[model samples]
Target: MTDPETLAAATVVVPALVAALVWVLPRTWVTRTALVGALATGGLAAALTAVALTGDRPLAGPWLVIDVPGGLLVGIIGAVGLVSVLVSPAYLGAAAGALVDPRRRERTYYSALLVFWSALLAVPLAGTLGAAWLLVEATTAASALLVGFSGRATALEAGWKYLVLTSLGLGVALLGIVLLAAGTPEGGLGALSWQVLPTYAGGARSALVVYVLLLAGLAAKIGWAPVHNWLPDAHSEAPAPVSALLSAALLPAVLLVAWRCEQGLEPVIGVGPARDVLLVFGLLSVAVSVPFMLRPMAWKRLLAYSSLEHMGVVAIGLGFATPLALAGVAVHLVAHAVAKTLGFCLVTPLLAHAPEAARSPVSGIARSSPVLGGAMGLSLGSLAGLPPSPLFVSELLIVAGGFQAGRVVTATAAAVLLALAFSCLVRALLELTLGEAPARTGPVSGSASASGSVSGSVSGSASGSALPGLRGVGVLVAASLVLLLALAGAASWLPASDLVDTLMKGIA
Candidate 1:
């Protein structure tokens, strides 16, 4: 067997290779092509994680850094990619039924999906900042195709908007990279490497500008507010599993880029200003997403807004820069990924059953499909930071860290935004999961007849009964619970004094 270090490159490359295979393979083989790609990537990610955790010093190539953080994120991207692929058949089955020519476009859809997965893996593991940025651009292109796979006017519009906005954002990021590179002793592409930037800590102005530009540019991709106009549209139009991968995996990949830049700049700007900027943006994103969540919309769009809220929470925790807060950020990322993916999965059946009315309407959820309804409820509750969910622990840690950092106003505002967002989510879920069935008439009913067939049957059959797929819901719920338990355990096992000491030592 090949050593894990050697396999790291393969882990990143395999999905892209599979994407090429999807394009070349016959239409009948698209599903198999996606499965092969997902499995290969997943296996490589697992191997990389095992080696990084157990080996003396895993891969450390000139263009790749398989450290603990990189390994953790790469493993997560791979795991989420596998789940997305598993759910793709059902999702695309529904989509194909809705599309004009399912057979002709199916190959394109699968190819783009595979490419998106590959780009996601590359974003976190790329050793050079420029390479990571380029990978993010690739993901944007791939996702644009998937977003528009339906060939509807709305889907095409959303795709174009996403492409334009993200391209502009990346252009800004590239300029930042250019500025940072120019400041380097060797200059040009040599300075673009993550390993090289820290060596030039003396150039304070250049480092600060680079940090600001990178964060702002990446914030658009991360779905931060003010620049987040494209998120809801793209997410609502894309296939459910694609939406899940976008929310659960892609957002965090961009964040890893932001965090890397933060680490490089902390020595120069100090933590104060850098943290303040994040806190401000975090607060704004939460504030903006809350009102949208309050308004009625499609289930998937609602989930997209929820993603904005959770990403805000992450930014807030990261802004604190305390060891406890950083740990909370990590925990929140994992919990949110699992919970959001589960939510997207549940929404799939809901959309199929309810369809879109002139006004958003949901009915017969609990009565017709108790398992899915319950799963949706639990996932939304977890996202809203309700008790016993890992998000609750993570949010509390973030708020505490904010106070400890002496940013009292920011902490207070964040708490308020969180409360508002939670309330809005609860209200939306209640409407969807507990209401009576709407009147079945008009075009809405026709669309529902077409879209809701599978969900209605599944829900009707599964009520007062169990199905194998329900096991997936159980896994999601259990994962969130375990995360909360782990947070509690870590709190007790690792003393605050030790944590502070360790963090400070790393900083110094």
Candidate 2:
């Protein structure tokens, strides 16, 4: 068998090479090439994850390390990227009518997606804070194109906003990195490696300042509140595949970088302040998202706010930083990735069957299309933390872990906030999947006027053919539901297991 490090490198390289190939390939071959590349990348990532998780020691080096956190995240990025690629051809087909130039769109979109996937795959494996920052900065450029791919006024505006805001945020992060480099006497890139930074800079007087700078900067990119103004618009406007990558892969990958900073700085800043910063951000994110989740909005927009809520949960788990909380973080990250990505993937079918859902909340979906409705319900239900969902299990562990960390007051506040968020989400889920669908303005099929016109029947058939890929969505949704259930069942014993013990050891 190949060594884990080679497998990890291949995961990043194969997609990148495919990206170049797609950029110049004939439009007819783009989808086939993309699918093959995505499969190869996902396979390599899975192999690396298996080694990192099941091996006796982490694979560490000056540039990359496959530790517990990195391994879990590598698996997530791979899974989400593969699913997004699988769904892309369908979404592009359904959206052909809206494109200015379909051929150019195919090449540009696939190339950008591959580039974005490659960058995200590298972030978790980065051994140095500097390397992670560079990888994250690379994502902003590629994803901006994807967010604005539709060429509509709103999409263009949303894409620009995403680019500007995230760029400014990264600027702040760069300043922090410069300060960190300045503080270390060795003063080389190696000094900023996770293993070296803490040893050299532990006693630096400016540690607190660096911590604030790093976390605050990363918050914007992570879509954490106060700085997350770009999230909803971007998610809503981007194509469904891109939205899945953003929510399930990009956001959590960036958060891992932030988590690494916290670990690297903890020795100097002490645990209390480090924990407090994360808690404040986590609480604010949960509190901020509930109102939006309650309001009637487009399906993708609602899921965007839900991202805020879930990211907050993970942050709180990090804030607690106990073994159980860390275990909860692991579970929450994977569960949220699967559930949220499924929710975004369903949007392609949702829009195909009802274009109105792009701008407004949908209803009577279960009544109209049972498969689409069931899939949406499962996705939303998992996100809402209903019974037997892994999110519920993970959130319970996080709150319990908070109390175990002796953060009783913080944990109590978080519990109350989580309950409120859950209620709001459930209300939204009901309104979305079960509420009365808007009354149709078109003539009923039995009406004499409708029965007399063959054009209407032809039109319906054409529209249905436009999204024939929807049948595949049902298969994906069924698989996601089964996977979520298995995770939930496994989560029960996670905190007491050896895996959790390994996670409790800091990422560095």
User: Which prediction has the highest lDDT against the true structure?
Assistant: 2
lDDT against true structure, model 1: 0.73
Best by TM-score: 2
RMSD each, Å: 3.9, 4.4
lDDT, candidates in the order shown: 0.73, 0.84
lDDT per residue as tens, model 2, 387-413 = 899999999999999999999999999
Q: On residues 317-396, what C-alpha lDDT tens digit does candidate 1 reach at each position?
A: 87887766766776678778878888776644455544552125465566556766677777777787777777877788
Q: Distance (Å) between predicted and true CA of 87, model 1?
A: 0.6
* Clashes per candidate, residues 3 or more apart or on different chains: 1, 0
Q: How high a TM-score does candidate 1 get? A: 0.88
